[model samples]
Target: MAESEERRGLFSEEDEGDPAPDDQEGEPRTPLSPICDPSHLLHRIVVLAFMCFLGFGSYFCYDNPAALQTEVLQDMNLNTAEFMQLYAWYSWPNVVLCFLGGFLIDTVFGIRLGTIIFSLFVFGGQIVFATGAIVNHFWLMEVGRFIFGIGGESLAVAQNTYAVNWFKGKELNLVFGLQLSMARLGSTVNMNIMGWVYHEVGEVVAAGHTTLGVSLMLAAVTCLLSLFCALVLGALDKRAERILHKEQGKTGEVIKLTDVKDFPVSLWLIFIVCVGYYVAIFPFIGLGQVFFIEKFNFSPANARAVNSIVYIISAPASPVLGFMVDRVGRNVIWVLCAVVATLAAHMMLAFTFWNPWIAMSLLGLSYSLLACALWPMVAFVVPEHQLGTAYGFMQSIQNLGLALIAMAAGSILDTRGYLVLEVFFCACLCIALMAVVMLYFVDYLKGGDLNRSASERARLQKEAAAHSE
Candidate 1:
């Protein structure tokens, strides 16, 4: 009787004294909130830093050849056709290996092993290149460059995929911006340093003071620096992997190569866009020095010097556009980039005869805009698990387009002449504009709004309902 009275007293206090209800069966419970952790933030910063280093190495490899092209041709005693063929050969491996790299990164190595192995290839290729140049063997140098392309292409795929993994929805646009900006810095440094190197070496050769061996040594030193940077990156990647495993309680599966067949239509459209942009861009890079020399009557050194300005502009432009996209929306930034690129291409085609400086400025803006917009969009469309394969496939397609356009551009210049070259660039710009239109259409079809926030919210609500049930 006493125990019963105590229970009644507890119930009476809850029922009569307390304003809050004892049981509210119809009301929903608040979901658990996610807490921000310091470790996660640190991991992201480390990944970003590593990605910047990789960008620096990759761009160094890309721009190094351009700076040394004239010297290489002279040293090897190659004609214009042969030199162009060698350049084409260097790109062919990227066409082949880009997809393979992507699949392997996603399914096999993830970022850690993929990056390490590819770096070895880059280091080895540079060694071979040095040897070839020292021996004055053109074929050997071509072979070295082909090997380098394979590794370099893979490295590029890994870096982009890595960015997706580490950044994701948190500050992703900013990370991509910084990544691209660093790459442009690499290109700028390559142009400035390589120009100086070539000039110094050319003077030495002219004075009969040193052999081509000296230039080869310098190239080898840069390659070693790249390899060292890769090693540091690999160590950091392993640390990140450890942290991820501890946090997630499982290691993520690496992407496999065979998944290319399963890519969504959205990814395929992105691939097409990438191809169109690169096809227009790389050929222009290849021919820019030549054009400046022939059309503007500038010396090779002066032409290369002017070309450096484009890369210099790109270094800052990427980050600014990236920040804008992060704050606003990707679609807005993409459309803006497309508009700028279209205008720049048109300006170049129309006014190269009027003022080369204007054309050069337009070219710089075009490169900066496309780079900032196009690269980050991949992370938006592709799932994290498939990032490697998607990047690889896109790169392969892009490389193929670049190879074809470069060859055609060279041939047209040789056969049909400069008018055909102008026509080709104009056509490429138009195609790129179409790609931008298609992207907008796709976005509209997905929803009227460009931001995916509403969709994400809906998904979360569904998940919460499942958990409650």
Candidate 2:
């Protein structure tokens, strides 16, 4: 009860105001530095940039396998089963660990500390992966991926927590979209640049296995960049807390594990959309290089480019779509449209002989729109305190589906071929579409906050606060 009362009217303020009454005492507020002024938009944009790059290393290293799919297979002599394990190992552990990781963010490490630690996990894991590749040890690489996975998903939770803590009532959707853009930027870079990195390193390493490993080791540089960002962001957050007269430690609030059973049905529906939709995207991208090669009869180079199209387009499109959603003010409608567009893209890939460039471009734009619409809604359904746990649980489930479906995707491609795999992806999107429709109704019955325009939501919040007085 103390926690509940303390959390009231917290983390929702988007503009500068006085500290809590007890916080201010019988004294007037002190002047803030120009940099510390809450009204400073430039300072916030700088922070937003840091938040955007927080996932850079994780996204870059994740698609390393996909980027080097042909190379890893040929150089390491790995079959589809072994190659897919790289992704499976990374995702499988996150199924449970990331949920606990999120809880830890709320209870023990707090967001700043948890983020730093998780980034460290990602860095260390990638090193292990690069080492395994250099030495030609698949098992060691699996272990590296396992460690990387531990930090990767939890790092995302910490990122979400940071975003809500800072931008919850402001342009939260734009922040989420921008974050997705930077992360996808990481992925796009990996896809386009890693091949070049491999070729360059192959000169010294003389090609084959060590070239792949060395390239991955070079890829670890982005992880280092992200770690630096984390450290700087932590310092910034600490400084902001002091200057803003915001309370620390008590700020994260508590989210007990037992609270999961009480989460809203709307949140669960969103989770279904999360897992069902992404299993199609990520897994398809993981296996997509080969898919394009086989189905479209493209060269290896062209296939990699096509496989990268989603991230490339999304890198730019996500922020734009996000701004549109912010302006339009109907998140549910945007999500549904994104889902339908994705389904259409998949169906085109599955059945039509049309140019894949068109399909991939449409798919990328729709993906951006869905990401812009979907993620920030969690912040609305759950209280600020529960944000970490809620985001963690959602990611936990998504990784479970990724782990299982990635392997299945590999098998389907091997045995049933690319056509069957595309169909499988289509099926997952169909499930996501249905879930979005159900979410629409459920959110409606609960007063429609999720679908409300920015003005409407702000009006309702003000009324609720006034009534609580």
Candidate 3:
């Protein structure tokens, strides 16, 4: 009895079952009618919306310096090397801490409270950042970024957990696609609109650090919005779990640090692929504005537009590609194709002076496709209890690579020209392409399950279940 109550407390801290009071002897309880029924599609969709927005604030604030690279330099009186440290600082701690964050999400805080706490950290960190900007203290701003980093990456893990929690087997691929779309949309909105917001803030505030700080301060509003979403989503999830009498997780199965030893080679290869591929995309975008201005002589507005194309295209393409991948079920094949396309895009950027719009557009489509197929593959290989840890390790590895490469890219830009930088990005993509090939062969040896169609996988799962029975 005590163990059962403890398990119940994981979903909600309150006492035994409290009646929902939705069916008050009136007009039947359909999906839309009750609006409170945990099993209803409407409730799940609402939860998914909040899940999308959960990462919006973090994603938006993450690229602030990227969008305003010039202004950050001018306002803080820093060079390119020092400016790149902003991203490095953000990525460095996430190297180790994100894994712990995931473990805590599984063991200590569960999903709901963990999310709220992380949201608060984001909100607080942004405030500190704005204060540093207002005071014109670069170190303070870096400290703020460090704090913000604590929440940002781990919050992503929590968001992923939420998606799996509510929508695991039903439209999960589409759900992941939509989540990535929304996160990238936040980034797109930041790049396009923050410049206008900066100018607007400049009109009222002083022009230098004051204006930059004020603009950054306003970003807190988005963090606040995310916090609200986290709170409401927690409440809704708790109620849903209670009403459905779901076991949030197996009470007896606890996460252990030693369990990582059990992870297969395929999962580690995915982590490497994530690290190899994204270092090219993200660090490039971080410094892309300057590359455009110098290499192509694009005006700042045009540079911002071209630089933002990847995210803009992702907003619509992710879901469509995700739905297609779901039907096709060759996730590894999709990943391979996406990596090859990305490699081609980087090659064009390196070898030609052709219109960057074409290169960026191709890159954008390729990234959307990779995102559609890559993440959900983890769910297939990992046990349900350890999904959080697997995701955390993936994020951590990716961040470590980003931290090192972002600093290197900045230094390379400072010393060598843009051409060399493009070559470097191309090389990273090559590594990604090779990793994907290796992953494919490895999974093929393990029954070719990774490349099988959805119907085939479903049939296999049923067979395995019957065999076990």
Q: Please, what is the whole-model Cα lDDT of each candidate in the order they appear?
A: 0.59, 0.79, 0.79
Clashes counted in candidate 3 amount to: 0
Candidate 2 matches the true fold with a TM-score of 0.82
Off by over 4 Å in 3: 1-33, 36-47, 164-175, 235-255, 379-389, 443-447, 453-456
List CA RMSD, all candidates: 14.4, 5.5, 6.5
Q: In candidate 1, residue 265 scores what lDDT?
A: 59
| Model 1 error, position 384 (Å) | 6.4
Q: Per-residue lDDT tens digits of candidate 2, residues 1-469?
A: 0001111222223222333222334555676655665446677778888887888898899899999898899989987767888999988887787557646776788888888999999999999999998999999999999999888877776776677667654466557656766777788888888888888899887788889889999999999888988898898888777555564322343445677887899999999998899888888888888778877898877888888999899777766776677677888999999999999999999999899999999998888788778877877898766775676577678878889998888887778888888899998999999999999999999999889997787788899999999
TM-score for each model: 0.74, 0.82, 0.85
**Candidate 3 weakest lDDT stretch, 10 residues:** 1-10
For residue 267, give model 3's deviation from the true position in Å.
3.5
Q: How big is the positional error of residue 132 in model 1, measured in Å on the Cα after superposition?
A: 2.7
lDDT of 2 at 418: 82
